[model samples]
Target chain A: MINRTTTAALAAAVAAAALMSSGANAQTANADKERCYGISMAGKNDCAATGNNSCAGQSKADYDAKAWKYVAKGSCATMEVTLKDGKKRMGTLAPM
Target chain B: MPAQPDGNGLTDLQHRFAHAVLQAPLAVPSGIRHDVRPTRERRFGVYRNNVKASLAAALAARFPVVARLVGDEFFTAMALVFIERHPPHSPVLAEYGAAFANFLEGFDPAADLPYLPDIARLEWSHHVAFHSADASAADIGRLAELPPEALGSVRLGLHPAMAVIASPWPIVSVWATNTHDATPEAPAAGWTGETALVTRPHLDVLVQRLPPGTDRLVAKLAQGIALGAAAEAVSRAHDSFDLATALSTLFGAGAITTLSQGSSS
Candidate 1:
């Protein structure tokens, strides 16, 4: 259950994740299912795929079976990050 | 002589992270370290909180039943002490709590129940075995084919994950009562003593309560004593020690593997 403080924190995290999600579809599809829309990629593997709109893929279902599917309206935008050991790798990470 | 910004190495980062984590509690010097105001200090606080929670969860993982035994408040206190004293030495979180049982032994609050620590030990042993490297049991067909003469002098090899623990307390029963859904009994009394065998034969490691005298034999085998000598020791400990039954029980469970032939060492 997301509390007031946690909900706010998650909101910020979701914002951060959304900004990072481009080009992550392939990686997100294979990752856990809790993720509504994630840009999942590791190392140099650059690919994208969708699980399902509700939460889609492994991530959506991974979190909970009862979670409803999300029908994305606009050109899909979600959240992500590119961590390189000690620092954050900077790039828009948007879908091309 | 020069303040070169070129020194950003992992060592520097580790030190920074460690300091940040330790000092997080002090942030509320006044309603929180916003003492470092306009600073993303909140994020730093959150990060420190996360670190503490993760380590606490790691300790809890090694001792779930212990957590249940102590209650959340006491468990939190215990976990805080364990983390400060035994921060993980390795990056692998799965293999984190070897020293926990001992820590519990020395823990002031839990010291009252002398048996608690040993039960923790048994649990930690279970955790390690669960993640331990897998080795298929030695082929039974080949074992049986070996010459009968070879059996007397054969040195039995235990799988890497085999662990045997003997505690003066009835720890195995205590551990079983809590971890498994069984009828709760009165607080244990007959400290006639207990011994446990924790071994990973395959995917799941089994923790079983062995007869009183079985530990000496298993310990002897663990120390590289030949099967015959180990048998001799167990027989001496308990006149009724059934060598055939015990050996077959272990062998059937994939507990015993690899027999070295030659002289009983």
Candidate 2:
């Protein structure tokens, strides 16, 4: 089950812009100034931490922000969810 | 009511109610489920809270400027109302907010800013096009090999993800003031015409405010007219249509390819 933290909820709203890094997944020059989150698979929408606070979708961003807040405060929980499809087969959200 | 069953897990009725809460804003009355928190604020299930959070986030994503315009609290409430009416059909959350601009138009609360709907649309278009498929400049060498005289006759192809929209309301300007990094200017005085181009070239998605004749020219070309004919059509309407500048721009932006010089059929 997704814990759904409030901090993540807020950050998710803020994470609406420029989620895509450049054409290549390379978080080259623009990394320090801007957050460049990476996705290992474009097909599955998986992303890596670019250290930038901004993520793309509000729900995912909010969830991530809440998780990171704990990291900022030196205490974050390992939040997880098993996504269930029509057959009810579930899978966990891989860590970013 | 008969003894409301406890919810260590969910029953059929509980599942149905939980799904509704998962999808929209609703008063989820409780007697069954409970929260694990020590304070124990039980509004029903985690499902309800998750639904609101996700939907609110979707609204914020779609209308960042609108959220900024109204401030976060007002926008959250607005989004809640929106989510109640329109839960997403597809799992693609990015495409979920398509109806927001229209909803805001009829939304009694936002009646004062009559142009809000159009502005929302412009923003939504930007949002959608921002994530659309965009490819780098194709082998321009193919076109480079074509003869100069043949340039106009060769049917140009637009970039895969380029799109355009024209609004009677000055939406591009409104969106810029609300979202861009440039020096802010007062909103465009009146709802004079405005046109926008949404295209992803290479990696960045660009939403450009087109010049006066640019809309007509792009619109004509979007209808698949050859380059010469589209340019001629715009030049006929506006004497100052600069064929050289426009062609260069569309090509560079990946909005046009294979410059067609052929006669309009």
Candidate 3:
């Protein structure tokens, strides 16, 4: 059961937190920053499609369900994965 | 399709165009035509490719760690499949990818890395926190002034941008490692569950790993539980739980937005 002691303790904790937050705000008050919508494009190839709509032809994805070829050959390759069933496995995608 | 007088023509045309563009092999909408040329297939093909590529690129930007986890080729191919299956519902690109984590759960290629879906979920949460509406911190001085007994009924409101994610995988560590200058590495062998606190107290989004039982505490507070009762409930389950530290963490992150008195539960 909650008692007077618990209530007092929580109030004290929250009060201390307010002081710490004010300190942080003061420090960041002078920092220059701007908020903007939309993220930057990822790479040169993203814009490499040259022609008006023809650039869309430059898209690399085959989009074929049956003849898939890409493999998950990223950082997961370095790590060994432990499965839920206590079986260990390499973090590699099966080649399609 | 010929234009109908009922004004459903535009909507019908847009649906066909969207369907054609999103489809593989460039299925041009039948009625499309270019002013100077007899056929618009080449021009239409460009539209199809741009739509797929740009959307895939947007997905890459939002989920960079996911892209890094699986190399570029794999990510692009997987993203294409995802985009085709789940096209954008809103004009805003940032709102896309809410279904990506679930998609990854069923993706056959990523079956080996079972943790990928959670990582995607983590990244999406961070994205949401970054874009969430901002609000000023609530006046906490009143809490100190309230009578000690009344403190149990005080309900502290958390920031709208704050979210707590409890996961069975070491999502925070994997996300942290790939976020900065460090080269991507394997997660530690003694993999344990992790809970993350995503918040945007000010301008920048922050993702902090929370200690055990803190997630339950935050989740309770988010549900409008009063301070004293929330603490009591959390303590019953988490022997290591400290009320002061949990409150301090929330404050330090600038996550406290409002405070009010409510019937103690």
Candidate 4:
């Protein structure tokens, strides 16, 4: 007993809802990830861990050891690494 | 030519300043003059030096091993030649050295170090892998769950940062020795070619020394070749190709990012 126009509108609404959910899922996935510091190799850092330069590949020393790169959620501690000060510490989600 | 105004309009002034910074030191561009009390030419020289030094530092940052191989003086001179020819096209400095390895191949002074170009290539690859976009590791468990009949037609996608460099020289060893060591030693008399696979699985960018025929496997898989077909191709090329070991290595390195079944032909 539904009219053609009503059926078409319902279909469009369902499609829009699906698209919104997918977009939300993608955002959540991205948010779940974090940048783990003190693990990236020299010239391989994702971006600035030190506030000096606003670019990648700017680490002054090999394993500048304080620089960071992004890793998946809950994977930061597993990347236990040695820092520039010769202290072995696990990577942190927050910039060190 | 008639002497243009000491400062043309804003647009002309900007153009002249840009030229002065990138090209020459004393030849301060015609339409622009420094406001400092020091001679205009001398003040302009400071800007000129900063531009050249920073760009050279960028090159050194991008190719530290290359700079280390050739001493600082030679590396800076060579970097200047490269910077002049291939000025950065983008604001992103990490992407600046795409042409450097090829430039080294034709550089006359570096002719003695024949392997320098390949070494540069390796460094560039490492640079690229460092900044490449992140991707979730492929679900190998799902790959294993596929039916045997469906496995032959499955294509794999590699992580965005993965790259394979096949070189005729012992470039991988040279890179490892120089990059990780303060006092790099020369390679032993007996040196052989190396194939390297660069990837960033977790947060660390790794340079793995790959065995023979493995680079071909990776290259094929990257091109969307089915797993079975890529393996067969490698076997055809190398009689001793080990499929199990290759797959294990790929998974262990977290190189593969996605797996999907290809339509059977």
DockQ of each: 0.01, 0.03, 0.15, 0.04
Worst 10 residues of 3 chain B by lDDT: B180-189
What lDDT would each prediction earn against the true structure? 0.57, 0.54, 0.68, 0.71
lDDT leaderboard ranking: 4, 3, 1, 2
Off by over 4 Å in 2: A1-49, A52-96, B1-19, B22-46, B138-148, B181-183, B187-191, B257-264
TM-score of chain B of each: 0.82, 0.75, 0.89, 0.88
- Candidate 3 lDDT over B45-124, as tens digits, reads 78888999999988887787788789789999999999988988898987999999999999999898888999999889
lDDT of 2 by residue, B101-184 (tens): 878988998787777787777777767666776555543344555544444434566776777777887776676555532234
Comparison by DockQ, 1 against 2, better one: 2
Q: Interface RMSD in Å per candidate, to 1 decimal?
A: 28.9, 21.5, 9.7, 17.6
RMSD for all candidates, in order, please.
20.5, 16.8, 12.6, 12.6
Residue pairs with clashing backbones, model 4: none
- Give the per-residue lDDT digits (tens) of candidate 2, residues A1-96: 112242232223112111221122222111112222221112111123344334333224323322121111111123233223323221223344
Best by DockQ: 3
Cα error, candidate 3, residue B238 (Å)? 2.0
TM-scores of the models, in the order given: 0.64, 0.61, 0.72, 0.70
C-alpha lDDT of candidate 1 relative to the true structure: 0.57
Worst 10 residues of 3 chain A by lDDT: A36-45
Ranking by DockQ: 3, 4, 2, 1
